[model samples]
Every structure is written in structure tokens, then in C-alpha cells.
Target: MGKITKYLNQLIVGNVFDTPEILEAYSTDRSVLKIKPKFVAFPESTEDIRKLMRFFNQIAAKEIPVSVTARGTGLDEGGADLSSGGLVISTEKLNRMLEIDPRERLVRVQAGITLRELNTALSVSGLTIPIGGHNNDTIGGLISNTPVDDSAGKYGGIESFVERVEVILANGECLQTSRLKKYNIAKKATEKSLEGDIYRKISKLLKTNAELVSEMSKNPTHDYSGYPAIVKLQYKDTLDLMPLFFGAQGTLGVISEVILKAVPLSKRPSRVVATFKELDAALEFAHKVKSLRPRKINFYDLKIIQEARESGKNLDGVIRKLEDGFVVLVSFDGRINSCVKKVANIQKEFPRNTKFIFETPENRLILNEFENALAAYLNSAKSSERVPILTDFYLPARNVSGFLKDLKVLEQKLDLDLALFGSYATSIYSLRPKFNLEDKDFNKKAATFLRAGAYIIDRQDGKLAGGTPEGRLKAVVTNTNMKDAEQILYSEVKRIFDQNNILNPDVKLGANSKFTLTHFRSTSLPKIML
Candidate 1:
């Protein structure tokens, strides 16, 4: 441990660990990268982060190149939340539900509170944040990534529910979006404060480049890479910096707390699975079902069904009912009569050969299993020596079929086994390719396939990273596709927030950083068995 580590341990209210075992645990995430941070600090309060930031700034004059990376549940892809060799601040200890105002239908929570914990607490008041089941992910991580989930078509993402956020900037200054009070004359006094200065600077940047900002905002794909272009998305006229932090992957600042808009829990939730003999037919049905505005619409192929069966997922009954082509699953939440009416309307628009399966409460559990079984099954299929590279591509709904075709071409061209999954409603698909790191030939082939896929997505004006931030693997593509003006704005924003580039440095902005396959953990056997 160094002097800084010792000082952090002494100052922080939470525990600081540099033990090999603990360091190893925090080294890697779901991504194919493993670089143990020098020290991992578990912070309990915002004050602790503030003090640490102040110390970091104080030490900056001494020419110490200390960096900070914050993590919630460690479920990120591409190692965006991982500190290469810097300090890792785990917000797990900061988990707390600060307040829940029933009247306003809003909840204020500490950043590290998990979705599971928040939903459990909200259940008491019959309220919920319908951002889907990222039960293991903390609120901070979820907001930071802005992931698209099963319920995204219905409730949208974290941005839909997030009303405000309290962020701790790099200089130990705290800024709150909800505290701006846009129309209040007292805001002038606040302008003189530290938070006010930040708000003003960012607001001016947005206003000055209004036209370019508008053009960038037109990107339909869901992206959490680089600085969030939040000028017009969150607010029409006034400034709302909360969206800036959303999907920033902690590059901008550390989220301390979030005040989210909550909705009442639906009493009658139901799901229905529809099967089609053709993939195009399934997609057409999905388009029609969108008119009814179903809570979620997910489409799976025969490969997914086969994988689930191989993994012993008990999806045999469902598979038996499915056609040779594709299956579309649609979920609805409302009274039984209302749901039934919507299903009837959906069936009318479906092709004559289409088969529909209405899921009972019992069957719903099985449907959930079917939905989640493929990823586990695919992992089981890969050898222990092979590392899985799950790449997310997002495009317009019309281009989904074409994108799938391109993926098929890449699979054949690369001679790799690729599995597809994700939210069809949002036209975002996850391409999971198996790679053996020890085999140099396999690594080169996988890289070629990824580069080709990135080109395809870019051609369609799609997002290379849909659900995850662009870390080492996808950063090259993100940097390539980013416009000159957007790049300039992102750099300026990053400079303003993280002046020293001490927060997740080079992960997003450093275009020169090459994507290499050497840092991942080596395994002789697969972690999962079929």
C-alpha cells in the first residue's frame, strides 16, 4: 500500500482493502478483462467521497497520477467500471433508501441501493420502478449505464424514471440537478456557489451548440458511451444535468443519490408467447403489437430454444408448441379483461399460420425461465479456455432483419459460433461469440468479426454499444463513429468535470488506446456445465 492508500483508509468511514483476495475479486467484471486495482475502498457516505476527492485534488500538485473508478454491483461489460491500476471505490456500502414520498410518488435513495432492495422496499407502498429486473445492479450503476431492458418498450429506461440526481464532481464539489429551481430568483445566489458555477457552465455549453446538439440527439439507438447528449432530451428549454450523468459510465462524476419517479405496482400482470413459421412474420406481428403498446416484445429464434433445451431449462413444452421459425413473446400489465382484449386485437393482426400461447401465472414462471435460459446454455457450450465476447448492436426496427443477416454472414465468414439475444422491441441484439484467448488465430478472427459487425452497425447509423458502455472492446468503433463536433463537446465536458482525467481515464476519450485481448483471466475449464 502507498501513502495515498493509507490516507484513504484512515479518512474513509468505510473499509479499505488491498488484500490479494479482495483485490482479485474486484479485478474483473462480466467483461473479458482482469486488472486488479491498487486499492478498493468501500465508501459509506457522500462525505467520504467528498473528502477523498479533496485529498486527490490536494495531491494533484505533487504530480501524483492517482485515478478513481466507482462501481456498484460489478456487472459491467468492457471493464468501464474497472480501474486499470488506480483506486476502486465500491459504492456497495452506500446502499440506503433515504426517503420515499408517497404523495409525490417519488423515492430518494443512496446510489448503491440495488434494484432488488429498492423494489422490495417499494412493495410495501405498492409502488415500483418498472425498469425491469436488474436485481443485482445498484441504482447508480443502472442509471450510469442506462440499460435497455425487457420493460424498456413500456416504461423506457432509467431516464424515464429518474427525476433528479446528486453528483459529486471530481473537485470534491457536489452538484444537484433537482436543486436548480429554474424559475426562482434565488437561483442567482446559487449561481455564485460551486454547484451553481458547474450548472451555469454546462448550461452555456448546451445553449451555444444548440444546433449540433439537436443533430446528435437524433440518434435513435440507445447509447451510454462518452458524455450523454442531454441538452434537449431531458428538458426542452431549461438545463437538466441529470441526463449528462446518465450513461456516462462514471466518467463525468460520481452519483451520490437519485430521486426517481415511482409508479403504482400493476395488480394484473400477464404474458403471451406467439410463434411464427417465418422470422419476418414474427417481426411483422411485433410491429402490429406495438400499436397496442405492450409492456414488452421479445423475439427468439430456434437456436435460442435449442440452447435452452440443451441446458435442461424445461422449455420443452413451449418448444413443442413453437414453429420451425421464430417466437415472439409479448407481455401486458392491466386487468385480465383489458389484457385479453389487447391479445385479441393482436391476434387479429397476426398471420393465419401464427400460433399463440397465453401464459398463466404458473406458465409465466416457465416463460421467465425460457427468456433467461439461453445465455446460461451458450456459456455452457463454450470450452473453459474460451472467453465469451457479448457485443450489443442497436438499430432501427426496420433494419433488425438486415442486421441479423449480416451477423449470419459474419458467423459463416469467421467460422465462429455466435448466439443472439436481447430486446427486439428496441432493435437491440446481443451477439455472443466464443473465443479462446490462448489461440492467437481465434483471437485475430474474433477481432475481425467484431470490426466487421461494428462497420455494419455504423452503416445503419446504429449504436455499437446498446446496453453497455464502450470500454476497450467497443471504444474504437465509438470513436470512429463519433462526429467531430460531438467529439469536441465530449472532450470539453470531460475536461470540465474530470479536469485531471483521474476518473476512468482513457476508457472512453482516449482514442489511441488499442483494444487488446491479453488482459483477460485465463481458465482451463468452463465455469458452467450443461
Candidate 2:
């Protein structure tokens, strides 16, 4: 331990700590998995990262096998940022505003910067990235996991906003990627290093396996599961490698810095909390609200309210008014009067018992509070350790209510309670189930439930990874859902980016159920150290 720590400290320009305290601290992320890494590196500069990657490359086939998992803020719920007996690169210190092209509505920032920090700085310029996340989530993690955010409904997915990325590849070489022209592709392929090799190999792979790539594009499960579909890799005249790494979960390469498209800060949007006695009524009303093209419609079932109370967490406003039902947070981009009319038009479609709260400030702050209320249960002293076993599934608006009801049936069958919340319009989910982490049967129970839950979702035309990418945890369920061609194509993609299989090996593309179950963590820490 001393030898490795000393070598790591001397290798990177930033700090490397293997102290028991530090190792234990970095072991647990927001996910329900814990993997105590051999060392945690805090590289201050891109050069430091390059040096480390070069070192890893040199040692790739040696006695030491290093699998690198770089995390922005360790907020990935799918266990992507964790690995056993390897180095974890903490990107928190790499945060820096390299450039902000306000004129072009673009911002260049280190991937380590949190969305909240970036927007806090961008507020002066009246600009922001619309696909937002937890305040602690780093921009790198945002791009890596591409988790479903309510804001994506109005704007788009994180993939839509990423203009360019500077990634440190497996061989410790840097590749600056963006939407590239045909000539650019040719030029890149002609290069002599790993960069050119990647361009050349992937181009051939896609061209040779054109049918498989196209088939993957049509597979809903592959939408956010593994690599971006090869068909979606290229447009008419340009090919962009940035999408390939969007949800790669650090298994492909390490995100160093990125140039992201920013939009004019939205004006104060009117928000309302609508509560319904029945989920069917709530989901039906949510669809009507979605037709208005509101910025966001966040839906939470009755289980959310129940969990909050069980955990001794109090939800304010109309959210608590629900005795046994669902709550929807609807936000609009215009005046309060416009919001009122939008609701009036759809109010008749819902149950007469449905209650609405037209909150003040007309901004998402109030709406955000209601959204954060779901997470507030985690802070409760009475809250048990809730494993996020069933996370991030998406369904069509038509299947949400029905499938959710089916989920309840499975829950009762398994006798495991779940907390459900997600963006209504897009049907991206963030569902977690309550469990006692200390229970010896947890792993088997979780695996059984995941398989059954996935069965229900698959039959209902729901994507297992609609909102979140299939990282280490969900990869098990999502992998089985992928077609044989889809699996082969993604494997080839990973081989192209990482020949040695050193960059987060077996993560998004090839993780199995055994690997996932073996790493189910029994311990957890506070979500945000800050």
C-alpha cells in the first residue's frame, strides 16, 4: 500500500491519497455499491491525467492490472464510478472555467465542474445548461451517465448540448472530438497514434456492420444503454465521436474538458403542484399537461409520499395533501396567467378531487424544492438504507400508469416496496426500493426483483435504461435486453477505444449479473460531504 501510494503521489502533479480514511471515503458513491479502490488520484492538470494514463498504459500488461474509473462528483446511481482494486481518479480538483463564449452561447469548462457551480458562474451572463442534475453532480458525470433530467423535456438530452469534448484516451493520448466532416474523418484516420487508429477502426466497423448498427438504432433498450448507435454516430456529412462517449460511463475514456452549448437563461417559469387521489388520474392529467409543451412535468406516485412519512421527512405544499395518490409538478415558460389557462384547459380531464398549488416566484426554485423533496427522505434519521435496485426505466406515456401498476404487483409479490419518481413527459424514471442493507438475502432478493421488474418493463415496451445509461449496475438487466448484434457492435466499439481493456473494463458494455451482485454494498455514507 505504501509503495503504490508513494508511486502514485510522485506520478501525478496533484495529490494521491491511499489513507484508510480517504480510501473508505471514496469507496461509496450515491449508488448502492461500494468498491474500495487501491488509490484515489486528484490530478490538478490535464497533463497530470495524461501522465497517469501513460503510466497505466505502460503497466497495462504488467504484473499490475489497473482499471481506471474516473468520477466527477461520484453521484452516479448506476455504480459506474466504482471498481475493485484499481485507481479512482477524482475530477473535483480539475474544475476550471477554461473559456466562456457568451457571444456564441457556449461555455468551455473542465468536466469536473458541477452543474450548479457552472450555472452559478454563468448566472452573471444569463446562461445555463438546460439538462440539469443534483448540485453535486459534475459536468463529466452529467455527460457520462446522461441521467434523465426534467429539464431535458424543454431543451434536450445532455447529448444535444455537448458541442465538443477533450478526452484522455486509454493510451494517455488526448483526442479533441466534435462533429467532424468527411475530410476531417479521413484526416483523423490517417494519423499514426491511437487517435487515428480509433477513427480508422470504428469507421470500418460501422461500415462493415452497417445492418447491425441500424438494427441497434431501432432497439429502444439500446437508446441509452451502452454506446451510441453507430447509425446515430454519423449525420449526412459529418461524424461525431462525442456521442459515443456521452453515456460510456468512463469505460471508453476519461473526459478532461468540454465545450457545451448553453442557452439564454429561462425566464421565471410558472410552476404548480397537482395532486391526485389515484395514479391513473394523475398520469392522465400529466399527459394533458404535456400537450401544452410545458418545460417539465415531474411525476411521483403515492409511494413517494409514504416513504417520506416513514422516513420522518415532511413534504410541504400540496405534495403532502395526497393521502394515497400521486403528485405532478408542472412548469411553464410564461406568465402565471398563461399557466392558469393551461391547467384550466386540462383540469376537467382529471379527477374532481385533484388539488393544485399555483406557487409564487414563477420559477423552478419552488418546483425544484418539490422535486428535491423526494430525495429529502434520505436525510431522515428514521430512513432505512434504501437500495436503488430499480432505477432509471422509461416508458411511453400510454404505458406509464399501467406498467407502474404492474410494478406495484411485482412489489407486492416480492414484498419489496419501491419509491417512484421521474419526468412525466419523457417517461424517464428514478425509482428506488427500500431495503435493509444488512439483510443477508439482499443480493439474491435484489437480483430476483431486478429480473422480474425488467421482465414487466420489457413486455410493456419500456426501456430498462431510458433516463440513465446502463452503467455497472443496470448493465446486467440492460445487457440481456440488447440484441445479439447490439452486443457485438458495442463490444467492437469498446475494443476500438480501449485496446488493452484498461479503461473501466467490463463496465457499460460487458458487466454481468455475478459481478453486479458480488459488489452489492452493505455500507453507505452521507450523500454530499459538503
The number of the candidate with the highest TM-score is 2
Instruction: Identify the candidate with maximal lDDT.
Output: 2
Query: Candidate 2 residues 1-530, lDDT tens each?
Result: 58867887787779987889989888878777888888889999999899888888788857466888898888788788886778899899988888898899899999899988898888899998776567778889888888777777767768788888999998899999878899999999999999999988988997898776776667545358867645677788788788887788998899999998888887777777888887777877887777777888888877676655665544564465555778888878756577678788677666566777776665346556566567765554234565676777877777776787787788789987665778887777755666666778888887888788888878788888878887878788878767777678788899888877888885777676787788888754564422
- Count of clashing residue pairs in every prediction: 2, 0
TM-score of each: 0.91, 0.93
Local accuracy by lDDT, each model? 0.73, 0.78
lDDT of 2 at 185: 95
Predicted candidate 1 versus true structure: per-residue lDDT over 37-117, tens digit per residue: 888888889999888777775676477867788899887767777787777889998899999998899999999999999
Q: RMSD to native for every prediction?
A: 3.0, 2.5
